[model samples]
Target: MSTTTLLRSRPSRPLKGGGVSRTSPLKPRRSRLLTGMMLLYLVYTLVPLLWLLLSATKTQDDLLSSPGLWFGKTFALFSNIQDTLTYDDGIFLRWLGNTLLYVVVGAGGATLLATAAGYGLAKYKFAGRRAVFAVLLGAVAVPGTALAVPTFLMFSNLGLTNTVWAIIIPSLVSPFGLYLMWVYASDAIPHDLLEAARIDGAGEIRIFFTVALRLLVPGVVTVLLFAVVATWNNYFLPLIMLSKPNLYPLTVGLTQWSNQATGVGARPIYNLVITGSLLTIVPLVIAFLFLQRFWQSGLSAGSVKQ
Candidate 1:
């Protein structure tokens, strides 16, 4: 064919909406708006934390004189920590230990019980399952504070008041955790997988341990972290249960120290309070950072089939 004929025979490309073929640059207004919203939220969440961090590094005088979100004239973070640890015959260290103990036992046990119960409720079909779930859902709606007075009275009658058990025992029943695990397990652990494991001669317990447990890691971590935080920050329960300062967790202990500021003998250690608050949150931040990858993996596990 001739070159002119061949050129004429080629079809012309259609224009989008029969308009100009010129490409428009991608509009970034939505992206910018989303970024702005994220930044606003970050600032809202971080401002208080920043204030705490900065205040921890200042002496009482400096804290009063200095700007709220900037460094003070003198950096006294190490000294503040030392003073916090050494204050009142080193009671802060004891409080720290007690807090750790409560978190380990209470949160760990809560996680285990929640995981088992949730998995059972999701996978098993037994008598009173719906009733149990209904009661659990109702329990979840009940604020813990509402139960504190009754719990105190009951524990007092049982001669368990002013003991570690008062704190640990109550924390072990996490209705929210149970509910979370139930929802997560229902989606994460496929029915077919469970059937396959059973076909291969696996017992229910063994299948749960080896198969469901692996898949439920993210939800488990979430519940465990929440339980840990709740137990760590628990004040009312420990305060109402235990009369002794020796048994106080960090939350109660810190508050006690803060109250000394206005007590008749008024020994204001605001620096230590601020410093201790900063230190208290550090472990939680570390836990999140460490478990973040696993948590992310667990959340996304069943999104795509293998």
Candidate 2:
């Protein structure tokens, strides 16, 4: 075979109406309007955070005197932190401990329950499964606030009001977490894999632990983060349930500090309040940073079919 004959016999590429090559790749056009809007949004989001960071470093007078985006003359950040920790007999530390306790027990329990329930719902076939799903959807739609009054009344009847159980108990029920895990598990864990484990004399529980659990890591982490954030940021439920100042979480405790600025004989602790608010969000930021990879994977899992 000659080179000329080989070249002449090769297939020709198709063209569009005006003879433009169909196989040619076109670069995506960038929209300046969208880029400018995004820049504006970035400024809007960062400005508040910058203001908070700068404000937390100032004394009460300096906070009021200094421009929001700029630092004050005397940097009192360390002193402000000391004051926040030591003020009112170190109640901030107590609130911190309480918040940790709630997050660990409530959020942790919620995740465990959600994982198990979601996995079971995804894999198992039993009576009333559709009903269970319907109930879950209904529960998810009903905001927590709507259930608060009834929950309070029930807790009051049981003499459980103002106790840690009041907060921890309610935090364990995460309908959204369950729903998310169910959806993730249905696709992520193959039915054939589970059946193979069973054929090899592995019990259902053993199979789930050794086989399905590994595939469910991203989904589990995603549910856990959601539960953690929800339980950590819970405000109204704890506010209405617990009247004891010592039992308060950081959310309610910080609000109390913020309110000290108003009314007669008010002691304005703006410096501590600002500093405390900064402290409050640090753990959440850390959580997102650490678990972000798993979170992103979980979100994108079912997007493309294998």
Candidate 3:
């Protein structure tokens, strides 16, 4: 036998315990504890939504009498929806319109502003950039509720209170969205690509619209969804700012309906309120489902290094 053939045929040494242990590739190991916890969490999250769905189908009397997680004898979902829409001269529809306005203008505008500002901050080298970032971080740390009183006072003085501007204006400033976009833009858009675009004689605005915006689809969708949810669910700002029911968003209007059930006059529109709440969430659910792919991509943006 040749020395080379002897070397090649040498036996491998065994690991500790006299053999190497290997897991089956097809059957990955999983922790039962973690699986149990996740199952519990799924139940926790889904139970309330189930209850809401079941409760919405009941009449006022049935709603009061029925088990929260089960359907009542009478399925009055359509009836409740009709009542919710038509009650008080279809004020619910007005509130729905107001919410759409706020979401379209306020959320849409916020996403635009945040994307521009964040992209600028990430790409441009300017004086006080660090200071601006510091301020943004501070703003994100400060909860909106903390600023509500001051915002109300400011809007009151400007005669903007009780107007759509009160809600729309404040909803436009999303510090978290700005921060998210800044981080996303920094990683998602290559600096070299922008330079190449500039070299190609494209103006900054044109570059942003053509190059940056396309690359930022995921981030933009994420920020837009966040802004929509925030503005749609905004309760305190609208509650404090607007006195007129006409200007009320779904959040405030639904709350007002809920409150009406408890006051001395006590108009128990529980069925309408429940159905309205269900209707209110449907759009958000659809938006999330539709944009889910982009949103997931956006969230996973910075997880891996290029």
Candidate 4:
């Protein structure tokens, strides 16, 4: 009879106020507003990329006259790509190669050095650690553009200006990346494991490489993405540091060709520029999609024994 009665009774009343909180009244409105804003933001962000994609499909004349949001011709994409490739003795390919090299050399080094330094700052205790961190924080505040002149002069003194090292070396030190690592290491890496590793006779470098680094991968990936993007898009530094046309990265190369497109009666190479720009983004997009796997945090779940 008790079992029958329990089966027949309504489920015990959910604890009154179990779900909604005091702030519940405002939630629907806030959610609606946030949804509206996000929709607007999506349109704003995607609109330009859409424009670029559509524009890349048009000829130079069609691009200027056509409504950018819609397609005028569906099949010009292949022809545009062909022209972009063959344009001006294949300088486009050279520029693409240069950009890739710069990104890999500069951003790659920065990611590694930042990871090591960040891990050390986050996990280790030594004299002047706080002071060193404070200095790094200050370095972040100093704009990269602001230091370009000083950097150029220093590089000039060393005969590094106008060379790949001029850009690559500067990119090796990212204060922002260091700070990110420090923050991530503080919150993400568990200290109990560090003690355990010490108990097992793991040397500092071994523990960091074999344990801490694998755990802090998301933070490392985040910094690497930023560094790669920064190095790829960098224009001002390369402008000041490198003058040789052969040494120009894509940003400078594109700007040079783009400017020449405006030469009197040359008929603007807008189509080529637009098309090339789209192609330039392909490697980065592909890289993000591929390297994202490496960025997963908590991947080292079993590295430190329970």
Candidate 5:
């Protein structure tokens, strides 16, 4: 046989130990372990939510009488929702509206500021950049709750207490969100793109709004969601800052309702509290679900290089 024919007849073999094998014995084990861990996490996360779901369907007596995780004899979800909305002259609805307002202004502002600041920090060679980052890192390490008292005092001195500004101002500054945007912008946005935009006679502001902002959408949405959740769930700051029930966010307002279940002249409206809590989470859940696609797309896009 010719040498060429002989070589051709020989089966092609992969280079020794160089390429990844299609089937590895360890892979199945790793996959199973990962799947098990994920399932465990899902169960852990869902259990409380499940309990909340079931508990919301029950009346106060049924909630006390029934098994904690199971449904009651009668489902009163709609009735409970009605009571929750109408209670105290629809103050719960007002709290919900106030929470939305805070989220819109505070979280929206935070996202805008964080995105601009992060993009600038990533793209620009500014003076005091290192010091700014150093302060930001330090601030990130500090617990927000620890600063609540001091912030309340400062706001009080400024005569901003009992006003929406007290909550909105504090919520606007998100060190972590800024850091996230910085990292995402550094990776997601190409410097060449910015230069190209400039070459086209675009101003810095124009480049940001037109070019960089489009790429930063995913990160911006992520930061916005975080800010929304933070502002929406903010309890301590509002508790300290606002003296009037009219100014309370849902978190504080709901807690006030829950507290009514205890002490003298207690309302015993535990059902309403549970239902309100359930209602309070719906908008956040919807926001997450709606924005999930953008978040995932942004993350995936950021992971790839130009």
Candidate 6:
């Protein structure tokens, strides 16, 4: 511990022929900067989410006047939840159920369809394949909102207006999902494996379902997550397609409550709307957390393979 002993213990010479090493000094500063930026980013993204959560626990007056993060003295978290659930003959529950139905059916169907289509595109070299892929690429860039009116008109002509199919049909055709699957399938699955399977007498369909399917679980999870969230949060399409309150998704139902809050005669449903919004996000949060491992592996696989 003495000064002379400490001096003797130090490096005998520079790592590279008397050239001073810059690694230590640069690493700490770079680490500090990265940590600080990450902390800032977390606060930036989470502050609004936290504010929404706190706002939900308070009454309407408390929401407007109280400090954003602090809870009001009277904890009405339960009361607000009750109001959210009970409002308008428990229509919120109906909307929640409808939202789940849409997400499960639409996203499930889309994921299945997209996976099959993408696998084929990536594995096979058929005529017009390039053109088909090009069309999907163009569709990926097209904003889905742009198709709402056209979709509405088409569904209306077929007597599908005000029905769930109007929303479900649109949700099925996710160009981005197909693109993701194409990229993932091409990169992750080996052509040699398919040839081996063929030599073993496995049919194309059987080979895909058995051999490639397990390998593609990560990509499937990614597709399911996006498809589910997109369908769950779809508001504009449903707004134009379905007019029935019973068919409304959570997003539409929340908007209706928000509108009611603005009305002069009705007691402001701001508290209920905020509370509903908070509850609405719970399913998505739970799903993402549950699938975190899958998504992490999928992304890492993409990076490592590249």
Quote the positional error of residue 304 for candidate 1 in Å.
3.7
Q: Candidate 3 on 1-306: residue-level lDDT in tens?
A: 344333333323212332334453333467799999999999999999999999989998888787888989999999888999999999999999999999999999999999999999999999999999888777778877998999899999999999999999988988888988998899989999999999999999999999999988878999999999998898899999999999999999998999998969888788888899999999999988878755665565555444
Ranking 3 against 4 by TM-score, winner: 3
The most accurate candidate by TM-score is 2
Compute each candidate's TM-score over C-alphas. Answer: 0.86, 0.88, 0.87, 0.81, 0.87, 0.87
- How many clashing pairs does model 5 include? 0
lDDT (tens digit, per residue) of candidate 4 on 1-306: 544333323233222445656466532335787898999999998898888898889887777777878876444888999998888788888888888888998999999998898888888898999899778778778887899999899999999998899978887888888877887787778999988999999999899989898777767888998899899988998899998887888888878878876657665788888898899888888987776555432223222232
Candidate 1 Cα outliers beyond 4 Å, as residue runs? 1-30
Candidate 2, run of 10 with poorest lDDT:
7-16
RMSD of each: 10.5, 8.8, 9.7, 8.6, 8.8, 8.1
Candidate 1's displacement at residue 144, Å, is 1.6
Q: What lDDT would candidate 6 get against the real structure?
A: 0.86
The better candidate by TM-score, 2 or 3, is: 2
Error of 2 at 80 (Å): 0.7
Candidate 4: count of backbone clashes, pairs at least 3 residues apart or interchain: 0
Candidate 3 yields a Cα-based lDDT of: 0.87
What digit string (tens of lDDT, one per residue) describes model 2 on residues 127-202?
9999998887888788779999999999999999999999999999888888888988899988999888888999
What are the per-residue Cα lDDT tens digits for candidate 5 across 92-188?
9999999999999999999999999999999999899999999988888898889999988888999999999998998899888998999999998
Global Cα lDDT for candidate 4: 0.80
Comparing 4 with 6 on TM-score, the higher-scoring candidate is 6
